[model samples]
Target: MRLRTGDGGETIDRQDIDVNQVRIGLDLSVPARLGGLELTPSGTVHVRRDGGAGQTGDGIEVAVGLRAVLGTARLDAQARTLAHHRAEKATASAAWR
Candidate 1:
């Protein structure tokens, strides 16, 4: 995912996505004196199968991120399921200006 904002002084741009093969998204925000912030959330979902009928399997995954001048951070979360079993994971980070 990618997100960018200009110093236009107005907040009026955003986007999102979710699909079977791949997913991506972006967001934008105007600059502010106190604090300017922008967030982008995106992920992918894929499925693969073998040649045999019983060799087919599927799963899901996702992630999210945020960026800013004052403070920047990103969070990622994912979940997957295969053969009736499920697993999930998450992580986060931050930075100072």
Candidate 2:
């Protein structure tokens, strides 16, 4: 995904792909904050099969994310899970001027 802010601001873009034997997927997110806070989240899922003409196999994936800002502090959280495996992570930061 690609993101752009106002003039004199900044732009950011990111992409991710998973190359595995069982599953393959991609995810992208971009967000900008002016005075308060901004949040954006997105993801995708794809499953591979042993032998098939078109897309096959029972592929299942889920993603959860959140972004928040209070005063001079900001927080973001994200979680992802595929098949039977699960993973989660979070981050918190602050700024002052």
Candidate 3:
């Protein structure tokens, strides 16, 4: 038989996956108006683990993201790995105010 997890990953033998994780994250963005432009240099960090039963193996993900906000628009000119790496992600968004 075959099975799959929420991580878009497949498992054989019903791997009996046991995922346990502890995450610490931080986001620091210094936003300010330079001349006539508004900019914010942002960054983030993440660390966690995904282990299977019998201590088979653990899947760990450590990602970082950097973005900038220009006026009412935000651009992720880099790998946007911020927030928790869940089953899904957000591609883009806008600021209402």
Candidate 4:
């Protein structure tokens, strides 16, 4: 679990724009061994609120993933979704080591 806050500003031409936000996140995972392989399942959630011009009111992100390891080989796969006022996005990724 984690919590964070941030403030930022940018200047373009002769105008200044500012943004402030607070975010909280939590992650959980469990691992189990089956024979010679280790398998883990994990999930995460993040919530955020923003204040400033053109900023979205609030947002949330959710994700789930799986990881497997055996000897020197490791594999991971994850899918995530981010949703906010007026827009939503989704992503997925996999990696091998």
Candidate 5:
């Protein structure tokens, strides 16, 4: 388990509207070994309050990921969803190392 808190600002579009937020996030992970491979699965939830000229209510984000390692090779994959007021987005990614 993990916890985090931070603050940041964003400029929207070309209108120069500024939005500021205080953010919080929590993460959880479980790791185990299967045969010759090591596996870790994790999830996180994040929330933030929007304030300032471009404020649009509140926002939340959720993500899940998995990582596997064998010898010197590793692979990771993750998916995330973010929602803020009338805006929403989803993203996914994979990486090998």
Candidate 6:
């Protein structure tokens, strides 16, 4: 249970919402030449329902990604896809002193 307030300091209840979600993930570590690499793979299933009506949506997502650390440089990449959507992201950064 949770409580929320508006600008006028009025209490609001959100117990009317019913939601279900499940997530599973796995991680692996492998030795790298300079540093190390971590492999992460995961999946998720979720559904939301409104009490007032039958408004609802369900989605499933799967993603496999990796993060690599080499000295002062860091690299990350991930590929994800959903039952109705798709997304891919990557990042790289380095620092010098």
Per-model RMSD to reference: 19.6, 18.0, 11.8, 10.7, 12.4, 11.2
- TM match of model 1 to true structure: 0.24
lDDT of 5 by residue, 1-97 (tens): 2334465555445565577877799999999999999999999988866677753456677789999999999999998876433323433333432
Q: Once model 6 is optimally superposed onto the true structure by TM-score, how far is the C-alpha of residue 84 displaced, in angstroms? A: 8.1
Candidate 2's TM-score reads: 0.34
TM-scores for all candidates: the values are 0.24, 0.34, 0.42, 0.64, 0.63, 0.36
Best by lDDT: 4
With a 3 Å backbone cut-off (N, CA, C), the pairs that clash in candidate 4 are none
lDDT of 3 by residue, 7-67 (tens): 7755486455565655555666677776756666665554544334533222223333445
Q: What is the lDDT of every predicted structure here?
A: 0.34, 0.50, 0.49, 0.75, 0.74, 0.44
Give the least accurate 10-residue stretch of model 3, judged by summed lDDT.
88-97
Expressed as tens digits, the lDDT of each residue in 44-64 for candidate 6 is 343222123333333344445
Steric clash pairs (candidate 1): none
By TM-score, the candidates rank as 4, 5, 3, 6, 2, 1
User: In model 3, where do residues sit more than 4 Å from their true spots?
Assistant: 1-15, 54-66, 70-72, 80-97
In the predicted model 5, the residue pairs found to clash are: none
Q: Model 4 TM-score?
A: 0.64
lDDT of 5: 0.74
Clashes of each: 0, 0, 0, 0, 0, 0
Model 5, runs deviating above 4 Å: 1-17, 83-97
Model 2 CA deviation exceeding 4 Å by range:
1-21, 46-58, 69-72, 78-97
Model 4 lDDT at residue 26: 100
